[model samples]
Target: MTAEDLSTGHTAIGSDPALDSKIKNYYTPARIIGTDYTYKHKIVWKNAIGFLILHLLALWGLFIFFTGGVGIKTALWAFFILFISSEGITIGAHRLYSHKSFTATPLLRGILLTLQTIAGQNSMYIWCRDHRLHHRYSDTDADPHNAKRGFFFSHIGWLMSKKHPYVIELGKRIDMSDLEADWMVMFQKKYYYPLYALFALFIPVWVPVQYFGESFKNSLLVCYFFRYLFQVNGTWLVNSAAHLFGTRPYDQNLQPVESWFVSWLSFGEGWHNYHHTFPWDYKAAELSMHFNVSAIIIRWLEKIGLAYNLKTASTEMVAKRIIRTGDGTHYALGNDDAKARVTAIGPLHPFNPSYTTKYEAPGANLNDQGLPLFHEMDVINVNNKNIKRNFTKA
Candidate 1:
């Protein structure tokens, strides 16, 4: 992932003077064009075929188990593949690469990149580009997968349509400078398809067939295709079901919500609201909350000197931005407040009124005004001999 490799087909970082001049430009948004505008029907057909075959094989696997042709060991292996692939997307691609929530060593990066490839999504460059756009324009038309566009649109329709201008020029806007600097990322990007073919498909099939006496076809069907399909859709569910359903634990400003069930399925990534609100935080689950398995894995790598700079939202910071509503009053400071209070004055200032304080109602509770408030403080009047003179001056 040399700088040149990442910069190819994309704008060079901080190189375009015209683009830099318009950093604050709001009237004319940047546009990407040139690629084919419409999705090929064949690709859709192939995707459908892949999904259908996966389901068919899963049902067949159940039948085989019932007839004693497949044992619990085989079923567990298939399940493991599904879990790893899903985690690879959620933890590796989404959190680590796209969000830069943490850092990983070359070896850890290789493992994650390989697992992500097996998930059969787009390459890291493409995925990261679309995801950055999604965060930048969430719930807007510009968002690649805005649930506001409808469940189907966000779930998969965006992939099928060529209506988005940015979709065509995806590589242009995304800055993959850090990733590009690493040789492993470049290697993965260059050989992703072959790696997927060898490791995800061939290896999974060959290993089981050789060691467990399982048929190659059976292993490919159950362990590879079936697992891939399940993992892909489970990841997509975060874009679709997570946004459409569930409660908003953090920012109601955005549509994406938090779902415990989705978190369970997506390895703590179902906490989408929290994620959107705090993109740099490694643990979307927050403290004492459900442990984020992805964060745990990153931590393990760091513990063994394979990862570094594991970013996380502080407890006070997360708490401040976490929405809690009661009695028609919405609480929770926005990200701006959280950042200012935490980063500027330090985390402890939230409890120190001299440094930080929220607006308080004099007699009645205030309604939600998109801000956080603390208890009212009483004011003291100082006695003065010249009170009449001061009143006359006023």
Candidate 2:
């Protein structure tokens, strides 16, 4: 069906009662009462088998390459497969579609959608729907990959088990009109399985053998098996490690954490804490910090006019909201500085009811010397006097 046809068929910008009922019914605590006792051994076994086979094939492929069975050309092909698949998940699936952090041209979007299909994840629609739910209800029971559900559940257990009611019923709750309007996304949603079979499995095997002189078995092993395994687990880490460990710079209460190590592995997505707090920020990490390769690519696309509306957070605003927990007290970094400066002026806490919170003077954009000013108080004078007193005592 054409994109126009699909758009016309679905109801636009309206609530779905069925979805609401399902969410309300499933999200209730009573539904989870007996879930703890359910048999999960089969799910565990299946994941174990899948994981084991993937590693076994990857290790075997590496062993063959080192043993003079596979040449450098084959190794290069393997690397290509891994790179493209990782980009598909990070740039295409997560950033562009799930978050709408930026807009790509139709041609670029189509190319990205095709690449993402090869990763063997669900269609863009399914992935985006679940991911939106994840963001909306992060760390709560309604979140599809809630970290509170334990490490394994967030990582892979959710996929192995029966489809959660939320998956089947919450379709209407998500505002995916933009995605639905895209022809490429709609096509991929309907025909993703066939595309996976052809491009991911058969084409990888046939094309390399026919054109590049690679054996069918080697192509399957290196391109299909090894690439597939790497992409799946790498994407999974965003759910498991991104939440379980790392620094919560933006919001301490949120489950997502910022880890430079995880960011490197997951293509700049490891800045989970900042992402959770500022979901629309395109660059997950700060510019002064370690560069996020994915953000670099997106910026490049923007420069070339292929991408637009790249969302970003101001450095000052980001710094202000960053939470610092030390000495058994939590404070907004921006507010803390302001409070400290105000305290120096008078012996009153900013939050104290008796304190006059109002300032009579008009805010100055700069000091007398015309130096650029900030929200923080002028502490140079106070620091100089304290230094003089200490020097005199010494």
Candidate 3:
């Protein structure tokens, strides 16, 4: 979390002197944890209004569905789109990209990226960056969705509220050179506005309305708006419900928990205690596809040879940790782990300081391994060097 903590083990990113200068010269020192870190809860009115409108439209969408206006095929189509879109975040952004729990070919990456775009989340680069921040500095002022702040804050209020100062600064400390090296990720980022519209909004609705003989109004509400809110909230449940209301059977000290309901809703990402405990495990849980649709889809992709290098923790590893920290039964307070973690101690991803140049880089940790990197996050350094070289040349 300290500047020194981030700077270690990282080589220069872009080979261009000017670019390196730009990054090194920019950094502002700031307090990590104190009363000053508190903010007045500024509301992002633009997003708030948009969400309000979407919720209203979703109500209409629900009304029509229950009243028999939507057909079975159209309903199924909406759900299908919803599934693919959610996968983009779960399998694509969260597991594949952020955690590096698995690797994907360009083809699989394209498919996941397309599905994620349909979900209407931010571009994968931004999504991965924020997720990395959430893990490395979890349950602190820096966590994008700190559950300690409250269920509402972690669930959706964080989005409507202006970002806390540390959230913005600590985010820059995350290592994202891997994403920068991805052609598809950069392509989507470069053209995210149109891509989000065409894929997330336009294409999804167009497919059903054009081919399924669905009405525009009905399809628009049911397929796009309502489905979007539902999908986003499903992802949010991992941030909110999983954190607040489940059993930390794996590690009773951490805030994350194992919630079967959240797992079902978020497509297997609700195994919170297991996930935080063994983050590199590709399954996100001990069981692979049981109640985890994302793991099922990932296994299918592996069968097709589009995914590889899937990482996971061993039974031996889990058993040792469980005996050391958990009873493998349920979460309870007043345990040894809890008393030790009374303050929930962790590495601080404070803002980087000591930039001697004029232009301030976004404070990207040239060495920031995005999140904790656990037992994984390691990749082909040779490829990164080549990519950064090419990037500088361009």
Q: Give the TM-score of candidate 3.
A: 0.77
As for candidate 2, its clashing pairs are none
lDDT of 3 by residue, 101-166 (tens): 778998999999998888888999999988877887666667788777778989998899988887
Q: Best candidate per TM-score, number?
A: 3
**TM-score, cand. 1:** 0.68
Scored by Cα lDDT, where does model 2 land? 0.62
TM agreement with the true structure for every prediction: 0.68, 0.69, 0.77
lDDT, residue 89, candidate 3 = 92
C-alpha lDDT values of all predictions: 0.59, 0.62, 0.73
Candidate order by decreasing lDDT: 3, 2, 1
User: Judged by lDDT against the true structure, how good is candidate 1?
Assistant: 0.59
**Whose lDDT is greatest here?**
3
lDDT of each residue in 1-394, candidate 2, tens digit only: 3456344454334547785565456544442211222433235567667767777997776666667665677667766767777777788988888876667898779878877887778888888878876775565444566566667888887766554454345435667887789878899888888888986788666766877787778777777776677668778888987876544546655556655556776778877767766665567555524637888888788789888767665655566566342111123343543333332134454223122212221121211112111112221221123211111000
Clash number for model 3? 4
Off by over 4 Å in 2: 1-55, 65-68, 166-168, 288-291, 323-394
Looking at model 3, the pairs that clash are 1-348, 1-349, 26-360, 175-368
